[model samples]
Target chain A: MNFKMSVVVRTVADIMIIPIIVFGIYLILHGHLTPGGGFQGGAVIASATALLIVAWGTLKDNKDDFSTMESTGLTMFFLLALLGIIMGFSLFYNSLAGTGGIFGGTVSGINPGYINTGGTVPLMNIVVGLEVVAALSLILYMMAKRSDALEVEE
Target chain B: MLYYILQVLVLIGLVSTAVAVIWFKDLISAAIALGASSLILALQFYLLRAPDVAIAEAAVGAALTTAILIFAIKSTDRTEGYK
Candidate 1:
């Protein structure tokens, strides 16, 4: 089956990809302060993956890499959650808040929002974003590959 | 007034596209219609003050879902039922 689209599509996709990736990253990093978070940002990123597949078909089979990345994200998220419990707080507790950790930096007064004020929330967002991106992209890639192997029914 | 009118128009568009999904004989057309409906729904979500859901819907519902559906259709048949 001819999987590739016209030259117009390929060119547009190539040009549009950078902005989409940047926007997805923006959503992930600003998740603590904005209306979007890990899942949303990851979805946006995965949409880019979908666009690429639609335009040029699956370029490379990265199923194993995606699986490893997904596992790594999930494991890190779990470990980070566990850290809260070890610090004498409940599960998923905000232990790093006001403790002056990397993400626990404090602000003086009613500031808009210090990027560092989210404590473990930002870390959670990061890990969750990683897992979601990997998981969704893998799903798309697998589906595309499976479709390729199928014989079109008459 | 304008807000209410805009909402009404969006809702109308959403409904029409959804109906088009079912009305179309071509599977590809249905998938494209579904994508249009989902995009309109995303706009409705934004109008309802849920930007987060709007973003999610636009990304997943409108883009990814359509692509996946098209992929599925291509593997099977473009027309619904009967060769």
Candidate 2:
């Protein structure tokens, strides 16, 4: 049925969710020069979603938003990948590197690290992070809803 | 010397947890054991000089999989078979 966790668990979940989300974003944003990437970051964010679902029972159905996000991420990823082709490069090419644009900074030899580098990689990481966050959250939400929906006898 | 010892201990923990996952009769206990196994595996991955795989495994394997299993278990039976 509509099962909500105890107050202690709920409070902890509330407190912990913020850091988890921030770390996930950081993972996605600095994926180029870091150990984490889109998928890992997305999964981390979805874990926060999972924590929410477990702490507080599934109430509002935000499936539509998540669906739109997943679709948008995928479409954007493809568009970004194909943009390199229009720019006279192969699919998934790093055309923006050394261009001094958004994510177009350059890295030479073995420097420390720079955030504004890695061309299309960071862009893909963001899009993939979006898709994964939506996808995994959607999955957790659906399962939580389904579990709630199931008929249980006393 | 210490590094090798730590790696060996982690591997041992990983193997024991894997066995515990199968040995537990209660579904919740089994799920928790599986989570422990995943965590130890993640640690092993970290020790092996692969932090990326370690982070992914720790996040996905230890957390999400255990939550899903518990949720699925709550809907039906909490034990093995019809005992």
- Candidate RMSDs in order: 2.8, 2.4
TM-score of chain B of each: 0.93, 0.92
Candidate 1 structure quality by residue, lDDT tens digits, B4-81:
999999999999999999999999999999999999999999999999999999999998898889878877889998
Model 1 ranges off by over 4 Å? A106-110, A151-154
What's the TM for model 2? 0.94
Please report, in order, the local distance difference test score of every candidate based on alpha carbons. Answer: 0.89, 0.90
Q: Estimate each model's TM-score.
A: 0.91, 0.94
Model 1 score (lDDT): 0.89
Compared with the true structure, what per-residue lDDT tens digits does model 2 show for residues A1-154? 2788999999999999999999999999988898999988999999999889888987478999999999999999999999899999899887888899898888898989999898889999999999999998888888778876776667
lDDT of 2 by residue, B30-51 (tens): 9999999999999999999998
Per-candidate DockQ values are 0.67, 0.71
Candidate 1 Cα deviation (angstroms), residue B26:
1.0
User: What docking grade applies to model 1?
Assistant: medium
